[model samples]
Target: MSATATDTKTLLGIALASGGYACFALQDALVKWLVETYEVPQILFMRSLVIVLITGTLAAHFRHPSILTSKYRGTLVLRAALMLFAWLLFYNSAKVMGLAELTTLYFSAPIMVVFLSILFLKEKVGAGRWLACFGGFAGMVIAANPTHSPNLIPALMCIIAGFFWACSTILIRLVSKTETTLTQMWATSLLFGIACAVTFPWIWKTPDLMGWALMIGLGLIATIGQYLLYEGFRHAPASALAPVEYTGLVWAFIYGYLIWADIPASNVFVGAFIIVASSLVLVAWERRSIRLAEKAAPI
Candidate 1:
């Protein structure tokens, strides 16, 4: 590639990652708001339908349906089912716990992922990472004190959602070598949408005009956000952009404060700091280990 083209790609990559953050932040905020005024089932179904439509249209226009390869069919299917359940947990948590609490609790998933990796993947984790995992649990305790509060249930739901998040991540990583990202995205979302559809009869509730708007807005923003995430990976390495995911916590805090009149406890803030710090440490360590391995490799 030409120097100018290379520079353009770099810029696009930065913008894509940043844009992904903005769009997802907005999507989460909107969902939090809409859940209060409408049924979770209605909102989720609409969001799923609209997101699938937008994604499907984009996939078609790109003329790269092959990107959705048929490999990893089983893993992709399982991941999709897990994701649908995760979203349901997410919506319930958002509705009850609002944003700040939910955000802090949900991020504790990384700690779980670390332990699960030890069990399932048999990955080598040093003492430092183990300490960091403990620190994350301490943070969670701070974020979710055992008070007879309405949000306690939601906080626990977020914790459960985190496990599913870890599972989905593991599935994706395990299958990534066998399938293309595009194929995975389409297949996962298709299955997820279908799963969401299966719940329609039980939880369906009539929605208002605002609910409709929020649903479409969520679908569009989330689709755009996910697309930007993919574009970022295309332009730059994952290591450079992975840290940016933490920014969602900031957005969650802001949304909670501005939109929902929800203020986090002192413990929540402190715990969130610990949780995010541990995650960054883990990611940085993993990257260093990878580079060291590459350097030690034979030509």
Candidate 2:
């Protein structure tokens, strides 16, 4: 690609990624709104259906040949299942939590990813990394205390979401090791769509105009967010892009406070700061470890 084209692509990728995060924040707010409008299962069903529609349309238009018939079938199914649980719990948390509180707990996923890599992939992580993980969880517990103005139940829900999210990440890593990202995404969408379709009828309800708007918006924005995330990672290394994901927290806090009138208690901010600090520690630790490994390798 020409230099101009490369620069254009880079700028476009950043815009897409940032837009994705904004959409994700908006989707969470909409889900919070829908907690009163419709059941979580209903929302999940509609959300998955929307992704399926959008992705399926893209598949047809692009004539992408390989999908679930790829090498990562097991990983795809597991990831889809885990992420479904994560989203369900996340929506429930949003119902009872401030965006920031939920976000703090959600941040635990990267730390969890570190430990999981050590165990499953046998990636060698060190003591500092372990300490970073402990610190992240500590922040979560501190944030959940009664003194915190943010409700405890939602924080707990967020913790649950974090666990599942981590599991989903592990599954993604396993799949990515063996299959194309696009194919993995396709398989995941298929499995999630099936899972949601199965549970949809139990919690299903016909939405009114506001509910319809919320669900559709939730679906569309979520799809865009997922796409942007993939595109961003495709263009830049995670070491660089990882920090940018933190911006989502800022967006979440902004939307929660300004749009939803969510005034976080003092404890929420304290806990969030700790969590953010821990994440930075983990990032630094990971980068250093990668550098050491690179130095040890033969050039």
Candidate 3:
């Protein structure tokens, strides 16, 4: 493909990624509201059920029903399991932490992804990327203000959730090489639904009309978010889009203020600025490296 086509595809990926993160922020706000009245498993069971139904329908329409028997099933299951663990940790923490704090802590995932790539994918890490990682963690520490945080355990859980999320993201990039988006969505949703079902009966609460609507809404938002993010990865390298992930923080702060009347502390702003700067530095460094390599290639 020509340079123009590649640039267009990358632009589309960034757009999709931004939209996906916005949907996720909305989903998180919805989850925060619902969790006040329902158990995490109950909420996730419904959310996963909707995703399964939607993805299942798409799979049928597309006539691509071979996901379960795919050669990459093991990796897919592992990805699903990591996401399940991540969500459980995230939503549980959400019940205690404000959205701004919750999101800032979880925004550590992109930084973690860079390091995970080095470890699992055997990707080379430059000095610049190393410095970016250091800067990102410093920002996390600054934003967290662990000494001052009242909900220390929940804050830690949110950070751990970010780590698990990063693992699943790496898996998604790996399997995207061979799997259709529908195939990935179907497999992940099926396994996620089954796992949520295991403890769902014990924690189940019959939903009122609003409760049902919100839970289903959560599912719909999640489906759109998942589809958008998956497609984004298809078009752009993860490095190209890492900075786009920060857009969720903007949405998180907006929703938090609008829905809950929550305002962030000064430290949160400082920390967020640092984190976003670090990620941007990493992206810029990656682009410079790519350009230099292209220039040096033999004719």
Candidate 4:
């Protein structure tokens, strides 16, 4: 592709990524609202039901009947389980914490992914990236500011959720080498749906009209967000999309302020900036490493 064409595609990818993250922020807000009245299991059950129906319909229409099947069934189940646990913690945290603070802390997933790659994949990490990783952790601490926030447990939950999320990301990368995107989506929905079902009878509460609307809207929004995210990767490399995902912080702030009148502490902004800078630096380093490796490869 020409340089101009590449630029256009990159821009499209950024737009799609931004839109996807925006949807995610909205979904988080909805979950936060719903959790005030409904059980997490009920919310997850309803949302996963929508995901299964939507993904199933798409797979059948595309005539990819095998999208529900995966060679890496074990890996897929593990990934889904990790994600389910992560969401459980994350949603609970969202109910108690400021959206921006929680999101900034969760954004550490990429940093955790880097460390996970070094440890599990045996990938080499440079000094600069190591510094960046430490810096990202420091930023999380600064954002959390345990002294100021009396309830530290929610922040801790977000941090743990981010770690599980990073693990899921690594698993997804490994599985994606052989499995289709649809397969991964189907597996996640199926496994999460089953999990929610197992717990539904104990926590089930009938929803009013607004509650039903929120539940259905949550499912639709999240599924559409995942589709847009998939489209983004198709248009550009992940390195290019990484920065765009940060726009989610902006969305979180806006929604938090408008809906809940939550104004983030100054330290939260400073810490978020540090974390974002560290992540961007890591992305640049990774891109350069890839380019250097390609140049050194023998034809």
> When superposed on Cα atoms, how far off is each prediction in RMSD?
5.9, 6.0, 3.5, 4.8
TM-score to native of every candidate shown: 0.70, 0.70, 0.82, 0.75
Model 1 ranges off by over 4 Å: 1-26, 65-69, 93-108, 126-137, 149-160, 199-203, 225-247, 279-299
The TM-score obtained by model 4 is 0.75
Give the lDDT of residue 146 in candidate 2.
41
Worst 10 residues of 1 by lDDT: 236-245
TM-score, candidate 3, is: 0.82
Each model's lDDT comes to: 0.65, 0.66, 0.80, 0.74
For 1-299, candidate 1 gives per-residue lDDT tens digits of 54345435544554576678767778878876787777666776777677677666766777644544555676777878777778889887775674446665776765666666667656566765666566656656666564544466777788888889777755655665455455566666677667667777887777778767778888878777866765665664333333445545556666778877878888768866875675566446545555665566566
Candidate 1 vs candidate 3: the TM-score winner is 3
Question: Could you tell me which residue pairs clash in candidate 2?
Answer: none
In candidate 4 the C-alpha lDDT for residue 230 amounts to 61
Q: For every model in order, what is the number of clashing pairs? A: 1, 0, 0, 0
For model 4, the stretches where C-alpha displacement exceeds 4 angstroms are: 1-18, 65-69, 93-107, 121-145, 148-157, 230-247, 268-299
Per-residue accuracy of model 2 over 1-299 as CA lDDT, tens digit each: 44334434434444555676777777777777788868787787778778778777777677765764766666667678888888888877777775446666687776666767667767555665566566656665565454346677777778788888777755654554445445555567667777767765576788888788878888888887877766654543232333344445546667889876877677757766875786567556545655665566566
